[model samples]
Target chain A: MAVLTDEQTMLRDMAREWAGNESPVGAWRKVRDAGEAAGFDAAAFGTMAEMGWTGIIIPEAQGGSDFGWLSLGLVIEELGKTMTASPLAASAAAASAILLGGSDEQKMAYLPRIASGELVATLAVDEGPRHDPANTAASVSDGKLSGTKAFVAEGDSAGLFVVAATDGLYLVEAGEGVSVSRRHAVDFRSHAEIVFDGARAAKLAEGGTGLLDAVLDRAAVLASAEMLGMAGQSFDTTLAYLKQRVQFGQVLATFQALQHRMATLFSEIELMRSAVEAGLTAIDRGGDTRAAASLAKAKANEVGHLMSRELIQLHGGIGMTDEYDAGFYLKRMRVLEQMWGNAAYHRERFARLSGF
Target chain B: MATLADPVAETAVDAFRDEVRAFLAANFPPSLKGKDNAMSAVEGPTAETPEQAAWRKAMGAKGWGVPTWPSAYGGGGLSREQAKILAEEMARAGAWNPIGGMGVMMFGPTLLEYGSEEQKLEHIPAIARGEVRWCQGYSEPNAGSDLANLQCFAEDRGDHYVVNGQKTWTSGGQWADKCFCLVRTDKNQKQGGITFLLIDMDSPGVEVKPIRMISGMSPFCETFFTDVKVPKTNRVGEEGQGWTIGKRLLQHERTNLSGGGSAFRMAGPSLADMAKHYAGVDGEGRIADAELRARIAKWEMDWRVFQLTALRVLAESKAVGGVSEVSSILKTVGTKLGQERAELIIEIRGMQGLGWEGEGYGEDELHSVRAWLFGKATTIYGGSTEVQNNVIAKRILGMLDHQ
Candidate 1:
């Protein structure tokens, strides 16, 4: 973990407490069981707003704490542990996009509402299932945008979309030409495939050529933070299980084989955390973060997948059952792995960024 | 646009910086710049060039070589921040600390913590000044990972103990002036029976034979003791407290082996760059072999993640005591990465990597092959990977012990 300031420590502790009390995995289970198209509970996000989590990254003038990306990452990591189903990550990414490129008018119109949790916004980059931002087919013409964005998280809930076009980024409200249809992913989160037949496009032209990539990089770090949480909780669950569950008249943790496996997972998870925190730090530093973002998400995907798999296998038969929460973590892990970029995607991207 | 010194000008830091500069300018010979004696790490006091000898002597006298140790014991007694400044300045000047060995790295710190006032008065000054060399007398043939199972007996004879036992893999044993030994004080109990004893290496019946390793280097020795007399006054702690003190010392050793800030770490082009030199590049400026390219990329990413974790650990541990649990994790990860890096280097070399002899092989190529072989001992030595996992599990993770 980073050497967090007193403020960051308090914020992280507050988020952990709130997530544990208000929205645990059971809360996500309820949302998933209810089959809501919006994915997360509205009341949960309202509570988030009340606690000022929805505004950590937004500037003070825009009704937020402006604590920065590391602060936001710390909050999101806590949310991730409890499997808190919210558009917090998505909305934050969208907020970052606007903050980076949106005009003062856009900031006044959207930042406060987003901070208050009254409005949810999301970044739509890939037009296909995979997260390929550079291969965008969406185009803007005469203040109108037309194209498709596949598997957009929080799409059903987002009132605004920071759409990535072939040229750059443009903001489009979720109405009229913007049609959101259900895209059922394995995690059962709110995902949508939206077809925009010339939606009213407001260009984020001030962000210049690299705006879309910058926005996606921020989103990747956000996703990595969540994965860090899930991976950590998975390890904690397994560690607790190993201590209690006995076989052959000895606790499972006593076995050298199991102990070594747990140790390996523990170290790998630490690396994953380091990568995520470094990425968040890089984003906060406001320097070139392309390589950092790729490495972060790549490690999250790599370790998250391994850890989720190990979480199940370590728990034995009970882990395979639906009643157990291990499978939920694996499900979420698979989805998040594919979110910003999978291991291979980011590895390739990292190689390109590193010029290897 | 500003120099690194701009922010701290005219402060106490600047004064100290000036003092350091003055000290270096007067004492540090320009001819010795950028050249660290490679043998310093693996061997003891080989015949040094006049400049090297002068450099070591000057550093020892000034005590800046062991900068963070107490000044009462002839050390610089600098704060952590000051030590960091000294490191930066030294690196900026292409200077490396010439005063280091097991005495400075592990034993000196442990002795300061656990040794008596008289013992500290007697021993620490020499260690701080890099005047005497020390070797560990802990591991034995019967006790590798199960170090407590050691059976080197130290029979009590009122004023002194007659030590009659052997300690293997005693690193730099032949070169050391003294040995910090773990001797069995009681034959009845395992851990409770151990005693920490200091023995003069030149004493009668003390023998050290350097063992040739697969790396073709004789860096370690098979140390034997045959009725070697060690005085009761030389005992570090209580008779039965060796296990506690020895374990604390191992923590220090493990931290050093963890490779966080060890000097003499490889420096040059990265493995990817080296691979490009060996294997041709494609049209897109990528490694020619896609599979090899991906593997190199993966290694770089993993290595990066490890380095970041090291940084985080350093930051989190500020204003705190020793990060004991973290050291095990560092040792396990760092050693594996070291081994992995050697393999990647070999992979980059292809058939050229296997060169071991005089003709046709570059000095670097031959050295790397030996380093690759020597790297295997790293994981096995400073608490093997399996033992480290046990440390993580039982100690750090609070898992149940074997009943």
Candidate 2:
């Protein structure tokens, strides 16, 4: 097992309890059945805020605990075990960008509300079909921003938008010239395509050039942590099914073929866990965050997808139906697999960072 | 990247690291730099040239050869962290650890745990000083995976035991000075009937024949003992208790085979460096071949992940005083990755990878082929991959027994 500090262990246990009791796979199923437009339970998000998770990475002066990225990642991982859909990941990412590049006045005005869950924010960086941080076509000219951003997670619910433009990162109010139309995502999460038609915006002090890359790398690490949680869940659930399900006059897990496959997946998941932990440690310790983040994300993307696919295959035909919880994990894994950057994208980025 | 939480210990370790770095810089032979010493080969101390002998003697005298062992036993008596620092410093200087063999990897550790005081005094110091070579005598013709099925027998004859058996795959048997053997003492019982004995390889009636491998090197041998006489005092533990001792020793062997103690070393140039030299870079400073670049990137990422996991497992074991069954996990994955790396090197070299000899191929290119061939045994030696899976399934996952 990976070593964890006392505080981290406490946070993990608390998050696990919350996910098991307050929000679980059944909760997501209920939300899906109710046809919720926000794609997640708002009341649960409020409960999370009350638990001080939304402020986990924010500064103490900003009404946060200042626990740092690793703590936040622990919480996210726990929630991911049940595929809990919330704005925590996106909002935390948006908060990180502000903390990294936001001016003091900007931080003072927005961070408190964000930490309190009174305002919802998310990064809108992707402007095209691909997951390219540098592919932004959005432009900021004379205090105004105009362009369309696709796959803006939690865009429909956000009150603040951290818009990435060619010039830099600009803060835009989610009112007036901002029109957010909810986009149907394969994962059934609340994602939107936002069109900014000359919206008045505030440019961060160090917003342009490399700011988006920095924020993306941080977000990628957090996202990989979530993927790790999901992959673990899928693996455990499959193993349970394998043990209980009997076929051909014996339990499925008794077969050497399935056991070998499960063992292989187990090893891959363990590897991913280490990579994700190292990434968070890198961010906390000021290491080569870009390369570490990319490494984690790439491994997580590959392993998460593989485990989910194996979960379905190993579970047999029942896994294909919406009635089984396995389908939800598969769907959620697909979205997370492509979020921030997919395996191929990060692999290329890792190569470039490594000077290949 | 995080600063050590314990500043005093950190400073001490830092000072130790500098001392080690300086010593290695002064003493490590420049001629031995970049030389492939066949560290994985289990063969006995081959007749070393004068330089190799001097280097080994220097390291042995400094007691840094086996840094973690007790100083009372001729070792450096360093902490695990200090040992890690020493290894890192040695790697940074492109110098290999001068002391390696079954003694350092398995026999010494086992003896430290199970051997009597007299035995420890006699053997551990010699091993620590790099003066003795040891070979394992666990498997026989009938007991490769079912190791307890071994038929080698030792009869108790008052003050001594007369042993007779054939042990196959006795690595370095042809040149080893000593053998840590497992022999049957009571044929009526299964695993309980075995005994662990330490015998001199030069004992009368002991014979060794090297077995050639596909790579054209014989790191292993077949040993036949015809009524070999061994003193009863040579036994490490009580008779009929070798099973437990043998299993424990294998844990150490598996850990060593998994590269747990050594710094990650590449047998040839790094994948990226090889790619750049063989496949020129594109205008964007990327490998010109897109597919090859992606493959190399994925392989490097996998290797990094494995390395990080190894470190995490080590740190966890150190903090909490127990080793996880993840050693099996490490062995399986580590060996597979090593093989994949070799395969990729061959792939990147194309036709140059196929050369067996001649000036057309660089030394690294030739080494790449041999390394690839030798790597196939890694998954098979310590424990076959299938056997590891069975262990993981039963021990870690709690899977049911099918048979």
Candidate 3:
């Protein structure tokens, strides 16, 4: 119910300007054609970082802007509009988890670098096929980490890693024992299979009292925010395409059928936005972040997946083709579909949280 | 997402709730107890006796016929939140609405917004007391979807307007005491040059013929107006501005129509309840097939979204001064949800859903099937979901006309 204020407006506008200038559809096409990932643009990430986006939600003490979650939600949404392949979303979310759950020294050590865009971080939570942090196959053994983490976004590119082990969070830097193998994913994001073969890791937060649970909860909220942005972009892009793409005696936009479809999709986007906002509000008000995060992630996963599929299906064959930018949004949507767990995972999480 | 934990409006709302509860408890007839009037698919006011009349008179005297409108205009003059409390209280008491039909649902609000002072004074009191029932005069043989292309003509005369038109799908037109109508005042213009006029049902050369449906219930009618005279004063708004007025009224109509199925709660066994009731013992307690249950779940989810979207609309209307373009989106989504939910209920009923003769199945399940079949109107009426998306695209999304 609290609408975006001035600071939120400014952050959103900045992201919009940056996206329009640096990660335009043409720029995305250029990157894609040059064999770069759809959302894996380092130059664009640098620009976003320069615009003070990476640290928008980080504290001022961490050499970052102290904007709220709503501001960060806006920035993520704008970046999602272009499906710009940058670890900006992952880095911000991972950094938020650390800043919120990490100790004071942990925050001081990692946050400043994250804020300055000197190091990028991605959470390696899914050690197995299932995206469950609690059911971790990857364990910490005597100050060393083993087992593999799949679908780690920017894992190959990231300099710092926030690994959620059985014990707690371990700060695993890019080193000899840690090998990052790039995983060719559907969304064309720079995903990786990070293998830790007895990798020496530093435990940032030990004596875990649901620290991994807390971090995963935060990750869900953060991923939901990013997905909120993705769905918004998908809705906008599809709407624009519907208007411009002419077919059979009238513009495809003229079809009432498609209009109705777009309207339904728009409603889904708003629902996702509301859920994400609710999670942010809960986090802001010091409410139960776990429940809110589950709700947000569940709502986002449902709407995000449905909207993305419909966005493509409604556009017909043209929506399926790679010539148009619709595919980019869909790609980002697929990546988000798996990021921080899918809809089913969140539904079960929500069920558990709600004591269903 | 603003915490309503200690919402500022709570005190007044709580007081209003108490007042409504006390009033309903005292006045609610024993005959109406456990009635669950809202659950009825074919909505007819349930209170039929003099006691019921007295109750209606008492509530209507306080302008509670429609609670949210201004008291001067024969409404309760309550804030929306207060009105919502009254509704919740009434709903809890199993009380039926004192008034019904197109007048209360669509026309009353329209008149309040666009009616002249004379029109308000003439119409509002009668409407509040349920003294006059109103019907819509918009759709024609060829003008169901493209309503603006209506051929209904009203020629200006010295002292009045002479209307000559045919309106079809006029629900409850056979029973209406009056009709608020749209007439093509100028043939030269398509959507423009139209006027909204009110005419007495008993006016000379006016006729209403009920159109019998497959359900054997004639909820709608075909009205033929041949030189039916309407007073100049009966016009709701300025000349050539009726199109705009009609459009706004339709927005209100969509709001009313979009909320159509929200009140549907069957007295005996909802589809889900019946599924639970008739399950396991029959075959592992799964009242319906897995596919059917899945479909039901999907529909239930759709219904939840529809309700949430409706609540969002109401919340926005309260937050902003007026309705947003998202109302159209709600209308579109809610109607589909209703249709889908009803269809699933019918599908879940299996062969019992097939009703041909009198009371073959239980009243609830049979009524559900009938309701499902009748729910086809969801897509067709108030403004097809098609037209709604056009509004969303052009007005809300700013995509259609951007080029």
User: How well is each residue in B58-151 modelled by candidate 3, as lDDT tens digits?
Assistant: 7787677678767887878987667777887777777877665667777888888888788888898788877787888989998887888888
* lDDT of each residue in A208-308, candidate 2, tens digit only: 46677788988899899889999999999999999999888899888999889988998899999989999988888864589999999999999999998
Docking class of 1: medium
TM-score preference between candidates 1 and 2, better one: 1
Q: How well is each residue in B112-138 modelled by candidate 1, as lDDT tens digits?
A: 999998999899889877789899999
What ranges in model 2 sit over 4 Å off?
B1-46, B58-63, B71-73, B76-97
iRMS values for every prediction: 1.2, 1.2, 4.8
Best by DockQ: 1
* Candidates by DockQ, descending order: 1, 2, 3
Q: Which ten residues in a row have the lowest lDDT in candidate 2 chain B?
A: B36-45
Candidate 1: where are CA atoms >4 Å away? B1-12, B43-45, B262-266, B319-327
- Order of the predicted models by TM-score, top scorer first: 1, 2, 3
In candidate 2, position B395 carries an lDDT of: 80
What is the lDDT of every predicted structure here?
0.88, 0.87, 0.73
